[model samples]
Target: MGASFEQRPQPWVTNISIDDIHSRDFLAISKIHGRWGGFETLEKWVCGAYAGYTAVCLRDSEGKLWVGESRHDNEQGAGATEVQYSNGDNAIFVLFLSLRGEDVIAVLPWDEWWEFELNKDDSNPHIALLPLHPDMRAKFNETAAWKYAQSMNGKPYGYHNMLFSWIGTINANYPPLLDAHVVASVMTVCNQMQPAYAANMWNEALNKRLGTEVPSYSICNCLAWDLPDLIVKTEMRGSSFAELLTIPEQDDWVYSDGRSASCVAFVLEIYKAARLFDPISRSIQVTEFTIKDAYSLRFFENNSSRLPKWCNDGDDVEFLFCQIRGRYRMELPGYNTMDPYPHMNEMCPSLPPKYSRPSNCLKAFPMM
Candidate 1:
């Protein structure tokens, strides 16, 4: 029994103002159907479907990267400010948010995010905000588009939800309706950028290119190749492989079938059912689904009868084969959650860790 997307909660909409970092040092590196952090790892697999940069571009034991922009009062001894990019040898400290194209870059000043109210507005401020829809952009800021953002006079960055679809900090009390108008306007460059094409098309494209079974997010990336090519890669939470591994509509990871460790069988089914091509890399990046839950993988027919009794009965054996298949397929990393403003509190870490440190590793960790 499948319910419709409408049955789900209504999608939250907000207003935002994004500015571009037109500098020579950093090029906007957008991944159209590619892996996260410029690498593939087990954690990348568990944390799949990254539609944002935070989940994809990691520190890799790195303390920080250089923010490009500099504040007027930036002193030499000032701490490493996470900015869009560092200004001149003049020593104006800035930070880099994520690396895009060969030279293009995206950045946010260190203080803007921390200075805002109760949300990511105060946390990761470097998120380049954008007006949510074409309609909102016209009514609020005139066709000026980010004029207010580009001309901020050292004030707390404020966003009207009507103008942008992004919610950084919300009004403690619902704000008053400022005003509105209708304009029969033609669309502009900022107007059209979306992951077009059906999911099936995404699947077909990746499967054809990689010569292997293309995951759902991969399908999205393949579609992205034609659409907006500037967005950071997605987060793993965008699509939950665990959600798929878990039975339909049930939060519980346990399967009703007699036994659950069916990793090898499922992997084989994936190979048979999916369109896989690259034998060398054998890569496929999945979401926040970890190897810890890897054991829960199950199949109806007997596939691992030759395995020992305990491993077979318990839902852990499937992980062993999944590890092999992961290496075999060369699965790449993907993104998880996309809410520029991530709410960690509401979201308790719900899924089990099938592999080592689902937050970090892409390939399953060696069974300790």
Candidate 2:
């Protein structure tokens, strides 16, 4: 039987202007909720809960607004650079490579970017989130934020470590039709298609976990095996694929000859550099964050009075932020309630056979 998908309602918008977003200075965070296309739908079904695209909006000293994000252009494939809006003049260059292929990191004018994002799709909803701390604006390190952004300006999007963010457990984290076996099967196929790409993405990560330098010849030989045979061979080596996969060290991870950061990871790394998560979330790896985890952090502004005038705070809005677009009401189920779980992703496979997660770890969203 085939699965039927529900068509979500159209998104609603307010008269909110770019000025309102600029008012928050370098602290405004923009997010789009709901699927825009096949890729985003797959993302929601696989890793994400509710949110789609996320970026940091910064207003520099000269009052110029900018948007920093890690994005992929489907048409470009491995050579993809520059996200061109329907309006040709509004294009942003792709500065770095992404592990998945040629995805790039881009920083572009906020007015142009924001307008493009709002009008990109009528089906998706958007929101602008601000920091909750009253003194965040006064204490924010604009220089450091800009410096960190520039440092990662042309780095690859963290595609190699993307799965680690969602697969906290061997089976629980997987959605319908997905499991460790399916993942291994996919990896086997990928290995057959591009040995080098598979080596860089999986072999290297597995090597790090095994703590032994497995030569290229050995890895290639192992990759040539069938799915069941590969698993059996992996067991013979004394480790499961789940155990061999580890959480990536965000600041230290190097792939495709450069550093990598996914869209959410890119945003959180900027936050970490700015010291926004100081003292409490300092030990948390920014790379481990999913869109749901990033938005749930307590750093966002919750006071209704401080939000923009156009923000609809009527009884319908569940979270602190205003719904600037989309037909359905936006909700962040675990907002500000997540307690940092040290190496939570790494402990997933170690859990009891049927247990989904440890009691102390944050709960994942239900499958949609």
Candidate 3:
């Protein structure tokens, strides 16, 4: 299966390292929730979003389990996140690859995913919501957990419920299959932020009815509103921004006409401090932008920033090297600028007037 994507398997193939998936008592899961086996629908969420293989599990000849991941590299738990070979005798680096004909059963451990770091600032702070397994069982199966599994092996691509069932299965699965726990966590990561949010809103409403901020109970303790209820920004599936762009037939009817549409993001900058409630408080934000109020649109960069795999090594620049297509252009604002200012470069977008500038656009936008 690994051979197909690259025309051949490299296992003949670089034997850089070896990891035994079975012998480890505990396999730390990196992304209790992530896509596995290259499902097309999951492509945009992780791959382009900068989420690579979440965790790599390997067993050593010493009968020990070692795990590592590409989710986030440095400054996490011990403030040290990547796995480096400390001793060659008990180390292995496993790379997750997409191989043709591999029905890879992606196991998501939802519970642990809740434990993922909660960060919001860097363009892709969602990484905090991902999970990683601990070297210790912390607590064994004693009403604490069980080894459960869910399979979409033969289900339709968008059965939808298959994903939910997968989450429940992960929660039900315990330590016997530490891998199962990791799988369950991965499934948890897969759960859209919906159920968590819906459950919270009502629970909070109930709490408010009681007239107190105390005594709060969360059906899903993993839900984090601070992360932003982004799903509400637009529809969950299909062409990225078609839902945002299309109105009911009474409005535009273009989407109803059935022609596939893609998103053209106009990434302007907004300067503010990064705070939990407002994302603007202590720090002076330099990058800000103002969008002209036409186009009935907002900007999200037709493309995502290409983050460097090694954060400290710093190869990829995460600015307006952005993605764009079809009539979008970038420009510097001027007093009484034309309705559609001329685009300065292929990467720059011409101003649209659908959106009124949100203040401090110059500080928010990167200067071309």
Top candidate by lDDT? 2
Candidate lDDT values, in order = 0.20, 0.55, 0.21
Per-residue CA lDDT of candidate 1, range 1-368, in tens?
A: 11111211111111211121111111111122234233322222322211122210111012232122211222222333242212233323222222222112122332342232114221211121111122211222211211211222121111111111111112211123311111001111323432232222122222222223333445354332221121111112242211111111111112111111121112211221222212311232211122212212121112344322322122222411111100011121221112111111111122213211123222221111
User: What lDDT score is found at residue 65 in candidate 1?
Assistant: 22
For every model shown, what is its TM-score relative to the native structure?
0.18, 0.72, 0.19
For model 3 the local lDDT of residue 288 reads 11
lDDT of 3: 0.21
TM-score of 3: 0.19
Candidate 3 C-alpha lDDT tens digits along 1-368? 01111121111112111221221121111122324324322322211112212222233234444332222222222311122222334434222222223222222222222234322212221121111112112221211111100111111121211111111111221223333335324434544456554333222222222222232354554533221232222223331211111111110111111111111000011001001112222222111111111111111112232312221122122332211110112121232222222211112112112212222222121111
The per-residue C-alpha lDDT of model 3 at residue 265 equals: 9
Using TM-score as the measure, name the better of candidate 1 and candidate 2: 2
Q: Which stretches of candidate 3 lie over 4 Å from their true place?
A: 1-5, 8-13, 18-35, 38-51, 56-65, 68-368
Per-residue lDDT value at 66 in model 3: 38
